[model samples]
Target: MVAPLSAWPWENFGRFKYLLYGPFLAKVVRSRFQEDGPEDSNWCLHILIICALRGLIHQLWSSYSNMLFLKRNRRIVHQGVDFKQIDMEWDWDNFIILQALIASIACYIFPFLENLPLWNTKGFIALLTLHMAVSEPLYYWMHRCFHGNHLFTHYHYLHHSSPVPQPFTAGNATLLEHLVLTGIIGIPILGASLMGYGSISMIYAYVLIFDFLRCLGHCNVEVVPYQIFETIPFLRYLIYTPTYHSLHHQDMRTNFCLFMPLFDSFWKTLNGKSWELHKKISSNLGKSARVPDFVFLAHVVDVSAALHAPFVFRSFAAMPFSTNLLLIPLWPGTLSVVLMMWAWSKTFVYSFYQLRGRLHQTWVVPRCGFQYFLPFASEGINKHIEQAILRADKLGVKVISLAALNKNEALNGGGTLFVNNHPNLKVRVVHGNTLTAAVILNDLPKDVEEVFLTGATSKLGRAIALYLCRRRVRVLMLTTSGERFQKVQKEAPMDCQSNLVQVTKHQAARNCKTWIVGKWITPRQQSWAPRGTHFHQFVVPPILPIRRDCIYSDLAAMRLPDDVQELGCCEYTMERGVVHACHAGGVVHLLEGWTHHEVGAIDVDRIDLVWDSALKHGIRPVSSTKAKTSQ
Candidate 1:
């Protein structure tokens, strides 16, 4: 049986009115024969074209608008929003095609009944009122259901994946989820038509308006004027703005309603910060914005202390619990147990902080200790380093300095693994070893004709050795392996190798005037140095203590200027207070906006330039020797 025309008051319009409703009339005539059955190819095709066109238009308009706004006022743009996520991939393209097909099929089956005189004012009002009254309640529940743990993981999580929602993200959903959403909107229109309360014109208008609002809600950019809501308090309840919808994406538990906040308010799921966030974003309209420049310094944890204390405490406690149970006094046994408990407690607390991914902020730069022990290039250490990089990226940090172990882990290709793994990451990673080498080389005493270089196999160690050799200083290379030492000597220039003297024994370094310990030097090794020898300890998590007779210095520290120095909240210490030369390299790169600098081995000639850039950003190097001497 044929579906009857919608018996609305607007249907009373004469045939002449059909000119104003040409598309609807044409659809009606084309759909007449297939009305006897549910299957209507002509009606389905028309609906598909309409929906596709609507989607296309929304995409084009939103993209154009975003480009214009970004060019004019970039500061107002959401920093967290990675536009790379919005690019159409194979899966996204397939999902969009499926959604369009499903929506078209659903629309043809539960079609909005036709009516004449398309522009009747009374009918339009009634249609919108019924649509809102029905759709809002249904959508609110459906959306809430989508947020349920099981459903969200399987279906709705895709849509919420973009923390900063964009216009394209509005329709990015699973096929079943999209069908449910489309049904919520289409059902109300169909019900209005079935009840003879809606004209074809009214249904068309609702669909167009709904599509427009849907796009606006997910645009990330807040377009609603703050004055409108302040002037008309009730309007907030009636209309859901872009900021209102963005909060829903950020936090799925609240703001469930699609178009209006009436249901959300009644249900008390409305986000409290929605209005505040909206106002904050709105205030940035038309303002110029730029990404803030900052450096992320990855610090090393004292692994030897962490490892040794635990082992010693465990051994001491074991004596009490085992063979020494009878030999040891009761007080000694109790003390050993107490010490073990304290050591384990400390380790547990420190481990908790590491797992928490806490970032320590300084006046000029941010630091995060990987909280791992030395020999930092293991799989476990690399994982933590990756986490640190990810954390830096999330903080909107533009550049990251791989300090200490971090540099070793990222040394080969300069964090190429991280760069490859995290394609969406905007933060640049640097090994900063070049600048560290520069600082050490520049500070080398001119009078010292001979220098002992240890850990020559390492990237930083080799770089420093070559730099010293270039300065015509005689280099005594000390390492555990004689073969590796010879390999390092072979790789150096003829003139550099001519000055290199490989020494397998630590005692061989005694006669050297300057001891440049790059890495792998323990306190025992440090003791091998003769009294009054100039000792430069460059390894992070410094293994050697300050000696009264020896001239001891750590890595060169960055000195901050007076004005910008006040910006950081944390105080600097000799060990932690001064930024390492490696970290300063990254800070300079960020401040200069130079993306192409070689991270692992920065040009030695650029040392002064990098140092100047660091100073410009308020980072100055304090003498490590001076700081140690005062202590």
Candidate 2:
């Protein structure tokens, strides 16, 4: 059964809900244009600020809570946030928008509210007193009532749907629950106003404090120092800890207080183990987190994509990464973060998941994709990669795979520099390009006898050319350097050498229907291919589909095995449960328990073996139809 107030009227609008403030925004702009001085009341602007502030407060707590390195073991929930829960809570700030509109209407109806002073010390004191006297107990009882059989099933269950509670979970309630919450929240402010003790500062302070406590309680990681309760034992009754509220989520009948445990204590509903668990979690604050079995070393693509990092936005990170206009406002802050990372230049854990009972994590080198091209940044990038490898070796990690530009030949010689420098390393270092070549090769049709290959003398290109030629397919290897071309051509058998033909111009592949793009191509170059030519790409940023008749594929990727568990985040632009071929390659190495470091050149002989092993482990390729859409 659905409650009458279960959904918002503008819920379907999605991100367009920001348009709700258009009229109020126009009013402020008009006031500014008309040169309305301090005499003109800007109550609408004040309400907007308060609403924005509340939302920011929630975001700050969420960002801090998700920092895994800060307090790993203190986290109440170990599971990652999945796309389903992310979608459900994407509109977590809906309550703020609703209250903003309500406040605007109130100001219009009760004109006196528009003239409230900016600061009033007495009003602030009265707001706090009223919140304690009326709001707290009222909310405690209201919360208890909602947990009853009828309301729990219809109205409150949605709020508790997320098994792993987060900061936004505080506001991820149904419209019906917010209706009651809005009233519980409004009483203190309305009472203070009605009693001749209300001001703008009072409203701001009360709402901000309310949001702060709400987010504090739901943040899965416990931040309140346990010694605070030990120093003043009775203070525990006045304030609730994250663990206290987490207990209510675990055993819903207990610890029902809103922000203070006094109400729960009075009602005999406080969980007895709350204090004990809090102390236990606090003990782990200074300890080192557990080591991961596998680590995929990655780097940021750009400032826009950086916001899609798991710690930045759970909802955004859960989906495929893309640049959006809404992210423009955040660019300045993101740039600052980039600068800081460049100065520090160290590796940090970005995200993690469990696979077959083993912990796998993605650790990012503090460098962007473009930075690898910079002459000065290359040394720093390599240093960070080496540091991460050494750290993984020290921690006893089984395998660490280099991703994207981190394994670039120009930057680190396909991760050969570190392997040579540390030959005694126990942890296997893998560039994972062999699997990358296999994924691109396996995607081609069995009848692809003659193919045009771009970047033909490169690491993956060479492997691909050799693999195809051995199967009696003619490979047109495009390259500007004859020395590099001949070096690769000679690696093939004498009979297959005839299959590898060196070409220098786009016109050379004009008649080839099978195109394997290992390098970027121009619109004019793409036009050289005949109609119905399917371009199998391994290029970064992928190529544009200029020809309407021709098809273009995305970067190589494979869907993980069905037994892979808790895979809650999309890998870059890859769909859910899908990962770059390089990432899957590392997993295959760990599963096979390969001791040799798979660095430097990609071994052509093992290409088929790696592909078969991936399939044997249930890792499947992205369907051609599905791969096209990712582009």
Candidate 3:
């Protein structure tokens, strides 16, 4: 078993290339940049010109290689059914290089960039290095922020919408985010407020080189290979891994460093785990899917628009429109969250549903109320699942999903994300794979007095109603035109129909009692209810026989749930889960499954200390939601 996160999969071939091109690279760098100082500057004019052309040659080669590979590998090219998987990002990278150079010099260190008095050979080198040193970190931190809660999901989420990212999606973002996001790109001009023309040249060079490298790194085909340089400590930091950055977009957040590794190393946020996760997800998600030309071209148009956005953004000076105009969508009101969630589940990128391996699982953080979901999904839907979980948990409800969701998202350190971000969500299902809907029929907790069903007309949804009918549990389901839930009740047995909950509380008074226990009692000490749940565990072999790949697995005793349901949604293509709340409004007798998502990481004895303190100071679980009766 090899180290998944530690080993670079490309090391074999990359090292071969490195050894083959050894002294040649040394000569190229030394001859072009004049590492020997004054002698190099004397030939600076000739050196830079040749270097620029040589760079152009390499860029062309890299682009052609990637395109050729895409042609050969038609499957990955046709990835998304709607071409969403294809990235069409193409831009005037060369032109931008020229532009950034000027901006860098003019906007920052204008005095020094002016190359005025300190105009020595070493001084030129100093200015360039200084410019790079500052720009890199600034670009990184700003990029990191763009992935933050307030920005990434909406503003930045658009850019990462693609799973197998293309070069065109490199810098694709809305104009506002693009410009504000690139605030660090103009370090020299923006920071030092430079006035010199030379500084602008430096900025141009920096942007051009940076852009070129980023494109190469993102290219589907590997040119030169990274292993040769990566193992060598210093050079390793210069190149960003394609696998690394792609995962940043896929299951992003952990690795936000770009350009170089300085940001990752400094912040200690360098996610070595991504490369392994990428291979894990890429294999599971089927990297062989083909994409359409139009999809690829769309990326091109988007990049073109994004690049032009900077130029024409402020041109609309008609009435000095307030930035507040964009505020409505940014607020992320209920509808926005719902729409995002709906879109997420429909897309194929949600790696949760297709749980091929042990990649889906989560860790419970005590301070936070929810579980952390961090599975390696190419789609960005984990946030949605996290939110759904929190929404369910906050309401003290347990969700039984047959939605083919890789519930592993929560088991994969998924708890931290907002409800909508779980990548387990996809655009839709393959005809009969609506396993999440099956949860609608699960056995309700005798303790739960209410039930809600959201997508009731689907197959599994109707099944849930049938199951609930048999259990004598109260259940309600919501319906719309396409779902066809009423057909379910009509098809249900007369006995099942008798259990349907309608006009809810009106007929509810006859049968059940809603009670919130005012006191905590051990299972042996008190009868919260005469009927309680029975949990039975059937031990099974590890999902991944190989251990390295199993580190991401969520089956350790600590990783497994206190209680679990299997053979239920695992292979069943049921719609509406036994525990599913089908419609926007439905009723369900909720059951809480205390999975590892809720208590896996907790130290029982430690909880005892806190419980003792709470008991003494009147602070505890029942401290807040306690119910009292007139005794």
Candidate 4:
């Protein structure tokens, strides 16, 4: 439980804490518009810009540090950041807002601070000197004091609570700790100002460098090459590396320096293995990569959805995904990134988690979902998927599951094209449609006699229809092609074939309570279902809920078993710890050690087998509420 005094005043405000800056923004706007404004000359505006810049710096570092492609071998912490840590560090920049408010008040009270010049060499030098002489030592000792029994429990424990530190960890602290940090940080700027030499540039330079070093230390990736320290032995003591600070988190008694290790050396508190461990880690940076036992191959949904990738926004990706105002400004840059990915056209690892000591990773194709629907994009999309499958085979991956449109029948024939092209391949290619069909099938009440199926001729649709008919349940297969419908109908037993009925319009399902939706449906089409009808969806970008009186299920998904570890990211809009059914299908395949390639059309015979195997392995459905609502 949090001590009431240690918690931030706006702790419960969540994303709305940005509103704390509203007053400062309103004042700046008033100053700009009013004819007789306080002549501070937009200093407040400059402060806001600098604050934003600091936030951007932290965001960039978080993205870069978590990028598995860039520095997999050099990652100091092998585990991913979980939702709990993301929430704890969500308000990492609260101090920046608090300081901005304080600075605004200060400018109002002080006269000489009205219109400082842009640059002052003397002030810059003075602040740097003060930082080295006064700030560093004071922070070193204060940081050590926080490690003591009393303060550690009361305040500093919050900082160390993040076992796998990221850039934001630098500023995630209790309110009391932040207050001390604010004072420690302000010393140099105030000292410079008091000594009659201060400039806007100096202020910017000092605070940026301070934040840069702080984030650098906490970023779990080892970025600074070891050669720099070896070349100048003195510089080793003068500056601290990311590895040096990571050691402090590992063993709290050593390496308590701020940005400089000189203070730690003076007190014999520096860890001896810092240099050696850093060199060992840095030497292996790009020479090797981690090979996973299972890989779930996925594609982007759209430009906005791409931002939810693990490497983009840590906090946004940790939660059940949604479109919010935060994504609007990032759209243009993300669109550029998407275009670049298309040009590059390579598969890259997106995120990973471990279950029972086996590694499971999600790798993404460069193509978006909409691109797969285009006539010309099919060849390029297949090329990327094929290359990814071949790459996984070469890397000794055990099983690779195709997700979303990556396994589309029109695109790669449900991943059969690649498997047939490379018969000698050892890795199993799975479309995961077996488990997908099973999830959607099992979600219906066991007594559900009739289910209206759309997209009835598609791979999943065909499998679902055959499986239900074999159970002697009535299946309304909605498809325009009678030939395709007959093809699926023949797959069922002769006695059960009579249970499968062909329907050309949604009007046929008006009386059915269990509607299995396999294709996109508009409000008009959906209105055909009766008032209590439950819409079980296997569609991409799930259909909107237009019927307030009806229930709508999320896309087929399963919650991972409790033994899974480091599962920090939600799969698309799935809730935390839950993954799309196909992704879970791949996981089940790996666990069962099933040698057969599960591509092409799903086997109706194995639907019950796969569903039972998934249950045995503890992968379960999304909760009733999560499955029943679009949220």
Candidate 2 residue lDDT tens string, 1-631: 4468888889989779999988777787788877763332398788778888998898888888877756566887777666677778889999999888888777766677887777877887888888788988999999999999988988899899987888899999888889888888888888888888888888888889889999999999888889999999999999998999999999999998888899999999999999998888877764546679999999999888889887787777888988779889999999999889878877888888888888899998888888988998888788899999999999999999999899998888899999999989999999899999999988899888899999898889999999999999999999999999989989999988999999999899889988999889999999899887889988887888777777777898999887776566788888888999999999999988899999888999999899999888888998754222222
Error of 1 at 227 (Å): 18
Q: Which residue ranges in model 3 land beyond 4 Å of their true spot?
A: 1-66, 69-124, 189-201, 274-631
What lDDT does candidate 1 reach at residue 327? 34
Worst 10 residues of 4 by lDDT: 622-631
Query: Model 1: how far is 605 from its true place, Å?
Result: 5.7
Candidate 3 achieves a global lDDT of 0.35
The collision pairs in model 4 are none
Location of the lowest summed lDDT over 10 successive residues in candidate 2? 622-631
Number of clashes recorded per candidate: 13, 0, 117, 0
Q: Summarize candidate 1's per-residue lDDT along 1-631 as a digit string, tens digits.
A: 3122212122335434324334534555666755553344455454555655666656554443344213224213333322234332112323334444554555556554322345656667667777678788888998899788977777777677755465656766666676676677667666666666656566567777877888888766667888899999899989988888877877778999988998899999999998887777777654444323454443323222222111122222112122334334444554454445334321110100000122222111112234333345345545656776676677576676665655554333556677778778777777766667767776777676888887766676776666666668888887778787777677667866888777788898777758888665777777787777777767664555656567777556664434332121111233323456765676566667777534544454666566566656666666767323323
- Give the residue spans of candidate 2 off by over 4 A: 30-41, 286-288, 624-631
Ordering by lDDT: 4, 2, 1, 3
- Model 3 agreement with the true structure over 1-631: per-residue lDDT tens digits: 5322222222345325223333334444665676563322322332244345534544453334333222323222222111222212222122233333343334244334334332234434645565568767777787788778866655666567655455545644444454553455555434432333333344445446666666655554433333455357576566666656655655565667666765787788777764454344334443453221000000001111211111122111111223444434434443343344345442211111111111121111111111122244323444444443444344333332212122222342222232334434221101111111221112224556444433344333455555555556565554444235455666656776766554222222222332111112233322222122121110111122121211111111111121221111111111111111111001110111122222111222232232233223321121111122222
List the global CA lDDT of all models. Answer: 0.58, 0.87, 0.35, 0.87
**Better by lDDT, candidate 3 or 1:** 1
Local distance difference test, candidate 1: 0.58
Distance from true location, Cα of 166 in model 2, Å? 1.2
Runs of candidate 4 with Cα error greater than 4 angstroms are 1-5, 105-110, 286-289, 624-631
- Among these predictions, the greatest TM-score belongs to 4
Q: Which ten residues in a row are the worst by lDDT in model 3? A: 292-301
